[model samples]
Target: MKIIPQLLFVIAIVIFGYFFSKRVIRIRKNIQIGRKEDRSDQPAKRFRNMLLIAFGQKKMFKKPLPAVLHLFIYVGFLVINLEVLEFIIDGLLGTHRIFAPYLGGFYTFCLNFFEFLALAVVISCLVFLFRRNILKIPRFWQREMTSWPRLDANLILIIEILLMAAIFTMNATDQILQTRGAGYTATGRFFLSAQLIPLFEGASTAQLILGERVAWWAHIIGILGFAVYVTYSKHLHIFMAFPNTYYGNLNAPGQMWNMPEITNEVKIMLGAAGAEQNQVEAPARFGAKDVADLSRFNIMNAYACTECGRCTAECPANITGKKLSPRKIMMDVRDRVEEIGSSNSDEDGKSLLGDYITKEEIFACTSCNACVEACPVNIDPLSIILQLRRYTAMEESSSPADWNNMFSNIETNFAPWKFAASDRFNWSKE
Candidate 1:
């Protein structure tokens, strides 16, 4: 019956692996539903960008205090997970402190290092929770951050705190058991967790053993559960940020992508030389009205968004109290994609443009590209906004009355004024 616990550990690992893999595959499929566009150019530049933005978190440094706090949680959580590797090995072999005998002092040193990181992680989580709930940061309490978004952020912080507590409990109890001449291995004291040893001063050996076992099980199980839950949360940014940064747009901030088909047709009409070179078939639509019409990079951006509201915070239109919130645009796209991916019917009589994101929101954008500059992961909300604008103008011929007037003047007078092209230079005579 001793091996039964090992068997259960193996089974838990298998189930967690299966579900996580399934969720990842589903996300990939959903992202692929959008049209393909080549983002593979400039491998060196892309790699550098991924390193700076995702790994180094260069953009996050814009806000020094939050950035430092985030670094503590990010770096500490990752380092502590290294200890989980030991947990897996011990659980599988039904052994305790499996590496201690081999590494001696080094094993103890590693545990002490992890304890320090765990304390840092716990303290960071508490600060984040206080900021979100007690202080009520404006970005975290935005209209887009409804009940579920707020709850998800708080839950992740709380889970990290509890997981760190479990580690301290397990270490303290194990040390107590070792001193009692129980079967527990004699590892040296971990500096941070050692402070907790006094709490179990008079506990029986059997009780200490039970506490250690319970903590051991809880910590590993909680880590596994957190891994799966992150796949469904805004926390998916943890994994998606790397690839999203690698595939980020390399063009200048103000430069917009034009439809090749339209550009070619315009050249042909003007009888320009080499107009027919590299000519391709026209696309079925001018711009994106739904997720399928958007490029794959745009869809990936939707999933990579952490909903941190940096984009919205930098938006000129949002600052002026317009309906435009760049963060909301990305969130709306992700919600639409999820809805479509999970739907049974192909045509749901709803689209990302009209159903999820409204015309007023898209129209409110000034094409300033501030949101793109503000995004930590290089997500381009402006690209999505421009695509929706194209559909409104070219496909539906539904631009606002003022914009239509400007379009007419540009077509007839070759400028946004009523003066003919021949008289355009007349003002220079003055």
Candidate 2:
């Protein structure tokens, strides 16, 4: 029986590791389907951004109430997961509470701290659920948030609450067993779990041990399951945020980037540089028409979106009842990416521009950076919008007639108005 459990524990670890690694590999491959660009400059600056935004969660504090709730869950989960280190050790060695003897008093302190955080996380999850279901925050009711998106949000919160409950229950039963001198290691007092001792008071030692074992197993298994589920959930941001914030566009949010390839072409055409000659097989697409045409950073941005609807809430277009929702844009990109990434059908030639995102939505953007600024994470829906817009304007020549007229005026008369060059200065004289 001892050998069977030890073998089973190793097998569990291997299976979890194998699936998690495979999902990670798939995500990387899907992200790599996009065009590449270097984000290597200013390493020190990127490090600061990663530290401040990802670690400190600087942007989230802009909204105090929800931010506080979010911080409770976010910080609490991270701190509480430290217990997994000890759990892993115990599982491998077939020992119970492996760190209790080694760390002595400090181990007790750590357990107390973990229980406190676990309680906070449970409370935070409950409050968030109330906000989503009862309070019905307007942003949460956006068109894109219906069906699966809404359920996904609620499901994650419920999972957190359950996971925390498992920890508290496990600790409570362990405390009961400790009093009976039941061979369970005493990790000292846990403030929150101590209050639950009454619930198990009439239980036999054998029954308490069974309950303790069940809760311990449930907590660990739930954690492993959560790891796999998150890759497919919006909660992937929990892992992606560090890298996403590190590669964030450090320039002003409102600042736009000219396509370097197009700029270089223009410069060469105007005889501005010593141009070499031919190119082998670089991608010929000038702007994104499909997921593959987008830059790697933009694709990553889709995955990093929290789908909190903060971006849509801040969007001028959305506020004005226009077709665009910046939040929806990110959601759609992620949905389409997942669809495409998982599809095996060769006939499935769907693309983001026409199939998922419409011209109306893309054109409705006012080019404002409200979405960029409002995002708690550094996801740039504008970049994705602009890239698709570029495809419409340049590759398809599908700009509106008025926009085409403006382009013609700029080309022929060097201004938005169709005026002769000589007459352009005539208005100035007046």
Among these predictions, the greatest lDDT belongs to: 1
RMSD of each: 1.3, 2.0
lDDT of each: 0.91, 0.87
Please provide, for model 1 over 244-318, each residue's C-alpha lDDT reduced to its tens digit, 9 standing for 90 to 100.
999999999899987888878888999987688969789989998999999999999999998999999889999
Per TM-score, the best of the predicted structures is: 1
Candidate 2: misplaced stretches above 4 Å?
264-283, 344-347
Could you tell me every candidate's TM-score relative to the true structure? 0.97, 0.95
> Deviation in angstroms for 314 in model 2?
0.4
Worst-scoring 10-residue span by lDDT in model 1: 337-346
TM-score, structure 1 vs. true: 0.97
Which tens-of-lDDT digit does each residue in 82-174 have in candidate 2? 889877888888899998988989998989988888888888899999999999998998888888889989999999998998998899999
Model 2 misses residue 94 by how many Å? 1.2
